[model samples]
Target chain A: MDMIWQGIHDAFSLTIQRDPAIVKAAILTLQVSLSAVLLATAIGLPLGAIVGNKNFWGRNIIVIFFRTGMGIPTVFVGLICFAMFSRQGPLGQFQLLYSPQAIAIGEFLLALPIIFSMTQGAVSSLDRRVADTAQALGAGPIRKLVTLISEARIGVVLGIFTALARCLTELGIAVMVGGNIANRTRTLATATALETSRGEFARGIAMGIILLSMSLSFTLFLAILTRKKNSEVTR
Target chain B: MIDINQLHVSKAGKSICHVHRFHLDVGHRCWISGPNGSGKSTLLRVLANLEQPTSGSCRITAPAIDIVYLEQSPFLFKGGLRHNLSFGLKCRKVSRDVRLKRVEETIESFRLQSFLNQDLRTISGGECQRIALARALILEPQLLLLDEPFAELDLEYVELVNEIMSCRPTMTVLMTSPHRPPESWSFDHLTMAKHTP
Candidate 1:
């Protein structure tokens, strides 16, 4: 208990000092998470929409795999990503390993399932009547999809937020694939890990504080967006 | 201008719609009414070609390809009412000016001025249905199939809808309902007798 308290105390002091190292790490973390989220959205959104509404050979199987991927261990994903981006790997020509891009790539994989599966769930759970209604209105595939997705806006946001949270945390992939390179790949998660392993309790505690704050702020923003008028909570 | 033949549909090996033969003509105002779970909607679904029959064929005389189905529930897209109305126009490559004109007409017809900016889910069921009707009308469909559209409407609104339906141009309309047509309203009606199987 004292160790934890002392670590927190020291962490806050260092963080408050505006340590350039800590600031750089925080920026890197945000960059990686944001990039991962954008990439995952680019890949996952359309895939989820198409997969949710259409049926084809192995469609069920593909969905099952995506859902299963949602619960995948971060380290497992990290290892896979590392192998793919490693010097001897197929994508090694890009030499992305140990770079911030590598961390983004790893985080992208971690966030992909979160975004894709939730999006799929949202699109599937959309009111069947919406599609029927759109079709009856002579809306085509693109228009119908746009309408359906909009109706399921809350669900879509939840999916994106879920992916963002996952990307923002999760140290395993960043450490393994990104090598936690200082001022490059060192995210809050990586910093937390590094501080703890080095017996730097205060720094670890500070990272924890920052992570908690980030998470809370993000969730609060989302909650505010979701609240509608005449909602009981407002009353 | 719609022809359906030997339409047989079953789900989980249980029959749904099994019409030996039926043909509907152009400009025909047909009413399909039946008890709950009697597949009235299913029969309409088959006619609309939205759902495939287990084993049957449906041929059209002049191809009601430009037909529209007015759903009981309105489906809203991401933006405002204008966005939802203009969506079909965008798909069909209609110009912006034409789309705006159509959307404005629908807004007035549905009396949706007050609710135009609100989300679809936030509106009343009656309003949603009206929005659905507006969306279908803007398509200029030659054929309209409605599924229990007035189920959620008030008596006054129902009368109002009848007045509006009367103004529809030379178009084939097939509306299904559980209640008898309002006495003040007149139409060419048909009945799908209760299942004997």
Candidate 2:
């Protein structure tokens, strides 16, 4: 217990000192996680918006499928991505497995449902006339979509931060898909795992500190972003 | 002219509108009047093409396919008021300069210039209704559909609605009310019936 506290103090001092390796790892983690969250949001927000806003046959079925996917194990995603990106697989030509890109893809799949369902809730819960107003304005399809997205921006930002946190914290998919390659795909979560296994308590503690710091930053931003928006929405 | 034959609308196996036949010629200002549960709003929704008539067809000979729908509850976009007003312009492929001009005119018309830069979502209900009016007028829609447009307005503002409706010659107005028509306005009142399930 004493050693853990000492290691935590050292981690903070090292982080404040701008230690090159820790900073680099932090940047890499952000790069991979942000990319994944953005990609997922891009794909999921519109998919969820369309599904939730426009009614067509079988929409409920698709919603059920997505809702069911929300709780899938990260290791299962890693395994599926590995199969799809391996040399013997159909997408072998891409050679993405065991790379940062593969990890990003895995994270994207993991976060997709989070962003999608939130976007679905945002769109469907809104007054139906909002869409009608846009349509009656002769707003084209794209214009109407932009209007809807703008209206749901608060929910989207929340969904994005949620995706980012999930991506950064997930170790199973990153480890399997990225191989936790040093100086390549090593993120804070993966580095923590590797460092702890090698009995390097100090290094693992530093990485854990970075992970917690990232989460804190995310939550702070979410609070600032949603404070005013949420107050008005509630009113 | 707006024409409908065999128009039908239903929800949860309950029919809302079953207007067997109706037609509104040009220069006709029609007021949809009915008792509660008589499908006045549903009839307007079908006419506006916002919702499909479950089992019928409708056509319009109006000018340029332009329409404005004033929803009972104002729906404010999340951005500044200008974004809400100009959203439809982008869809019409109207140039930015033209859009800005119309926005300015509409803002002045509805006395919303004071709130132009305010975030739309934060405004009061009456203010939101004014924003909706700005959005509707900015597009120069030829047909105007109002679903209880005066619900959130101050009593003083209600009298001015007719004047606002008459400003543009090409604009045709349709308002649905559960009470008698406004004085000084001639309207063909219609009642909607639902088929018993």
Top candidate on lDDT is 2
Q: lDDT score of model 1?
A: 0.77
Error of 1 at B65 (Å): 7.3
lDDT of 2 by residue, B94-139 (tens): 8999988888877776777678555555678887886787677677
Q: Which lDDT tens digits does candidate 2 get at residues A105-212?
A: 999999999888888878887777768877777766666676677677778777778778888989889888789887888888888888788887777898898899
Candidate 2: where are CA atoms >4 Å away?
A222-235, B63-65, B113-128, B151-155, B186-197
CAPRI verdict (incorrect, acceptable, medium, high) for model 2: acceptable
| Docking verdict class for candidate 1 | acceptable
Candidate 2: give the clashing pairs: none
Q: Give the Cα error of residue A46 in candidate 2, in Å.
A: 0.5
Tell me how far the alpha carbon of residue A144 in candidate 2 is from the true structure, in angstroms, after superposition: 2.7
Clashes of 2: 0
